[model samples]
Target: MNSASDLGALAHPAATPAALPTFDDVLAAAARIAPHAHSTPVLRSRTLDALAGCELHFKAEHLQRAGAFKFRGACNAVWSLPDATAARGVVTHSSGNHGAALALAARTRGIPCHVVVPHNAVAAKMAAIRAYGATLHHCEPTIAAREAACAAVQAQTGAELVHPYTDARVIAGQGTAALELLGHDGRFDALVTPLGGGGLLSGTAITAAAVSPATRVFGAEPAGAADGFASLQRGERVLELAPDTVCDGLRGLLGAPNFALLRAHRVEVLLADDAATVQALRLFWQRAKQLIEPSSAIALAVVLANRERFAGQRVGIVLSGGNVDLDALAGLFASA
Candidate 1:
């Protein structure tokens, strides 16, 4: 992957320090999205915990509205807009989860929503976006194409842009998941969440920093889509790479503001290979009796892979989403 020395030169500009989301924004987002977003339950599995040699607290975001934690950010963004701006509508580019989430959020406010989706996006997720009453404009599966499509849609519709990950409002909204998890119990030794565009992980890190200063924050990334890991290691954003992973939800490049927040909080990222992620997915389904997508399962895969880091400690893992295409389940498990 090619590294960008100037993070601001990336597609998304680096956020100014004052524009970055804070714990206060997270707190406000919790209240703003309280009525729309679900306070998903935290689950436990003794068998799995024993296998990993750590106490696992699963924040079940798969049960969240629109079937993912993306809803929290989407809902917050949709609601935070002034009435005049909201009336103009909202637009975003998402592979799947965020598209479906923005659609649902816009519906709640009775506004027009447009999603710029890649041609190669998961069928189930595309269906979900359409089902939620959003206009879907298909584009090639490249960042440039997606952004161009989104820009065109915004120009034509005069819609406000609610970027999937980089927007401060979205980051604040995403933080609510970790906020809820930490609030549900006492302090945890560490918190882990899947890292895609860094929205969820950045939000989690911010929440942990403010609420539980001692808790370490970790990001679980698919080895195939390890730009977040590379970016952190090199102290610059890695902007070029073709992600080759079964974790479809994590294919996006890490956003500039998202990277900034993560770096500021000193977040560590761990990698999980596709085979291990699939195995972790199967384990969660069979042992926890809960169905989670490969993207979500990677968090557990990292924990299991690095047992020494988390052994005998309480760890919170955010199951980011559950919007997998049911038709492909057999193929995914068969490979594992």
Candidate 2:
């Protein structure tokens, strides 16, 4: 694999602009969020390694504050604002994890936050957002509806818009997880994260490029909501998709800036079916004793699906979140 320094070989010259977040931005984010974000542990699972035929290092972001890696980005974005700007508050739209994350981050700064959520959002996650003291605005389960609601909230409150994935600050903040992972565990042949709107994947790719130059970064996406895979295959962003997946967090369309970074870094995407993902989730709970959500389990699912590709390799997997709706667990597992 070409190192991040060899961008000329992998990236289209005009595609990656100077404005995108770099390794320096990631470093700044690490420093900024040090007091707030957890330096989540890199866990090793010998049983999992034996099953996948690879040395697996799991970045335990599920144990992070607000129960997900989304906290890292949300915390950074919330705190990065100047006091004057932050006083006006912050707003964004999310299906679940990011909404809860942003709500908690806003609370940490003692700022008001508004999260526009889809009506179909998971009840447990919505409760988490409400518990964090953010005002909730419900909309139809569509990207357009969410954006419209967020715009209305922004207009009414004059709150700064902290986009879930596309914001440069959020991207930089998200990279800090990989920064911690690589810094603690050293280099790996491959690194994988769950692909939602691509914040984590983009950040991971950036960190891998700069820190572990030879590490290959991969995004594990659900086959039901494989827009990331489709976007890369088409060489352009696909703006709309009615995602049909069990992994609610992975349902968002890929952000433009995130797509650019993934393409620029030559990040490869792998897909796993819902059945396989659920199986992997069960396996993780059984062996690793980690109750990660399906979105997080897709990384392990992809690795298991393509054993030959990762066999005997030191592979790092980010267990993105652990917020599972307990009421729906039986149905989810039964389908598997």
Candidate 3:
């Protein structure tokens, strides 16, 4: 089990605002990262829309740089660094997407990138990170160990840190997903996403509130790793989780600032297990003809199960990433 200390937690001051990345912050980040990132496609599936009882506009962020929506946040973070700081390069701890995003973004800016990755991280994503020019630091599986490792790396190398989901800049950058969704079509009645460390969910809240105040923001999480739902229900942050789900990317707990943001936004969280996620993934593969990770499938499952909540409404969903291991995917449908 990866301890909480293995995954680096963002250091937040006591006075940090729970309501963050105001519309201005999002707009600024969008402007900063616009030239570097792609306006990933918005996909529509009539069958899916009809089945879910909603006009589903899927923001295909899986097609974004580094095969995930992570690039936007990483690009904004790296570019936000001053020349003196950037010269030392940027560092982060990621299981996958953020590492590759940071690596690719850093490469574009002609700066060094260092990623502290778990030994068990997906090989393809690790390769992507290295291919994009980031040096790799292998770490223990526990969140605690990951954090301890990152601290040592930052201290030893003097590299500026770009936390995966907790930093204000990163959160602001993530909000652009919502910005693009809203900009493309500002008529969504609600925005839904999968929450791991709250990057996408926090951004979704900021964007939904700004573009459509009445548009509720929601998150779907794996039942076994449902810390976000548990924490939201407890009204206090939960920061401990064992990495034990098919949705490997959604293993971590929500960050301090991110929890605060979700609280401020009053975001609703739903829990779905691996079985439900797999079923939803298969349905998407067969019906929508889309390939999505287990975490992304959680969002789709929420829409499918809570048909009444979203019935007759238009909803925007961010299909965050698609770096699934094809070999492992066979097992997902073998029993079905």
* Each prediction's whole-model lDDT (CA): 0.87, 0.85, 0.82
Worst 10 residues of 3 by lDDT: 5-14
lDDT over C-alpha atoms for residue 61 of model 2? 97
Choose the strongest candidate by lDDT: 1
lDDT of 3 at 56: 94
* Prediction 3 global C-alpha lDDT: 0.82
Q: State the lDDT of candidate 1 residue by residue for 45-90, as single tens digits.
A: 9899999999999999999998899999999999999999999999
TM-score for all models, in order of appearance: 0.93, 0.92, 0.91
Put the candidates in TM-score order, highest first: 1, 2, 3
Give the alpha carbon lDDT tens digit for every residue of 1-336 in model 2: 111211111111123333788889899999999998888888888888999999999999999999999999999999999999999999977646778899999999999999877776667667889999999898876556666787898898899988778888989999999999899999899999999788899999999999998999999998977889999999987656556678877876787789999999999999998999999999999998888999899999999999999999999999999988888889898878
TM-score of 3: 0.91
Candidate 3: misplaced stretches above 4 Å?
1-20, 142-145, 240-243, 334-336
User: RMSD, model 3, all Cα superposed?
Assistant: 2.9
> Each model's number of backbone clashes?
0, 0, 15
